[model samples]
Target: MIVENSKVILSVKNLTAEVEGVQILKGVNLEVKAGEVHAIMGPNGSGKSTFSKVLAGHPDYAVTGGEVIFKGQNLLELPPEERSRAGVFLAFQYPLEIPGVTNSDFLRLAYNTLQKQKGLAELDLLDFDDYVQDKLKVVEMNPSFLSRSVNEGFSGGEKKRNEILQMAILEPKLAILDETDSGLDIDALRIVSNGVNQLSTAENCTVLITHYQRLLDYIVPDFIHVMESGKIVLTGGKELALELESRGYDWITEEVKV
Candidate 1:
């Protein structure tokens, strides 16, 4: 578990959202600070993924109520692109394949866009090539991946690696990994976890949304939260994950109801 002096990076207050006219998140509240990793775990339909998407300002979900503050700004008010430029990153469970765009080009464009937003000069192609090469080492990805189309024909592990590689280059202040460990084998899981650990620092925070306790083993979290029926019903330290893994969520759910 990581600790900090307690500078809040994200503060969600009674966050309520819905998708396609169906309510999903129900007043979800959470607080994350720099230098800490928070894991949100729960069964299916618990609205874990919905919360992550809402933070990223996804278009499909509409915020019906509540407030979200990220780095002292009204997060819900920002557009998706603005959120990305503001150092909010989301590594999706399913990375899309862009057939026409090469990975190098895509990454460079994304990186340069964020750089421009930060009032930093955009790297030219020549300099960006050198920069991306260095980031590839973070994920231990092969150079050939840069030449191929984005996520095209890559294995499951490869796609996840690419997502981490993007995080490496982007250096986001808040990284939300939405079940990035879902389909990865043990080896890939370690590799991905290593990258995430390497990137985490006192200046940034990480939020992991996962279903299994296995991921918590590799990336130890400072806080473990149990989400059920669109709300966080319990919060504890790392040991809570082990408890949930052994006892299952039923007992916790029943206890919360009582």
Candidate 2:
């Protein structure tokens, strides 16, 4: 539940973006307040992923028009790294594999970097190990995975767990998870969703971009949005997911057109 007078963490106003000269997000507008969880659902090619990418400041997508404000600042002016530092995190749909970097090292570096930016003391390797170990419990990750290369040869479930581990450590103010439930079996999905629920608090916001209602079953959203073509045409409470799941997007699309 959102607190009384909870501040808005993110606001997108008439946000339009494109990739390689082709428009993907067209006049997207959203208001996410602290303590809210929002789910954006749509059919294929409806620009759900593109919206997340654009919010993360992906270089390939150019903002043609509109504004994105985060924490009272112009989000569009910040580069990706700066946005990360400012507590905006985007969990990729497909977590990348880095063959040379150990998961522990990569996580520590990222955690320490954010600490340094905040003018806080950085933890030594030993200290970071203990800190990250505690975070691993959020996702039920094993300690052995820490020594292995980052997501190298990790199964789909492991990769997704590692992503949650990253989130647990960094503790961003806003987390945008793009298709995070993809390619996971039931058990993995439950584990990941539980971690996300543990991480959510009254001070942070979460935006989940997905294509199915199963994900919402685990990580319930305060609001559900339907995107058609390149825009969100409908917004409803969690019950809307059930409606969409039963009747499909055709009815929503047709309703919007009418």
Candidate 3:
């Protein structure tokens, strides 16, 4: 399927993938539009991360069935870098450490690469430094972070802040944050959420893939979807998250099994 200019940015219908033929997602379906935030919640091993990886074109997870359409094109047909250049960004749950590369350099590479993908000119050293400084302010990161290696020796909070820094700079059309709220203190959570809020608008969409509702308290989503086994069994507004927080997944599992 091909689209020239579509309003729906992402469409995942019956998306199924596997690791070494071990099925993960089963008939999963989701859609995201610009200017909205959608949250995916599930128990352990529920394929939440698999869904993110598949969307991002991770080589290890084989797409055994289903389709993913992003920005009017079949996403699986593109390479991971290509997908990212097309305005799809996935914030990793565990960011890696680059020993030799300073955070500033890595951010510049990512920013310039994204701009190049848009057929825009790359930022010079001066422009790049200014750009990153603005983004750091968005995440409330310390000014000294620029001198450090990419996440080397960063505390849990610092690592998460650095992730947010990337999100703010990229300004992706679709941002999939994988467990972004984990390992953050209250102040850090607020700072990260505040950054996301400042960046989010009606023209950009965000997907918060998380297990706890605590994060939702800060970055309230427009939709909350609960995944179990492999499929999404419940879809509701933010209230559903509060309900789940009080009653647990047992309620939904019992209802579905009955």
Off by over 4 Å in 3: 1-6
- List model 1 lDDT by residue over 1-258, tens digit each: 366476899999999999999999999999999989999999899999999999999999999999999999999999999998888999998999999999999999999998888899999999999999889998899999999999999999999999999999999999999999989999999999999999999999999999999999999999999999999999999999999999999997798789
Report the Cα lDDT for residue 161, model 1: 99
Query: Rank order by lDDT, top first?
Result: 1, 2, 3
Name the regions of candidate 1 deviating beyond 4 angstroms.
none
Lowest summed lDDT window (length 10), candidate 2:
1-10
Q: Which of candidates 2 and 3 reaches a greater lDDT?
A: 2
The residue-by-residue lDDT of candidate 3 on 203-224, one tens digit each, is: 7889999999999999989899
**Model 3 deviation from native, Cα RMSD in Å:** 3.2
If scored against the real structure, what TM-score would every candidate get?
0.98, 0.98, 0.95
Worst 10 residues of 3 by lDDT: 1-10
- Cα RMSD for candidates in order: 0.9, 0.8, 3.2
- What is each predicted model's overall lDDT from 0 to 1? 0.94, 0.94, 0.88
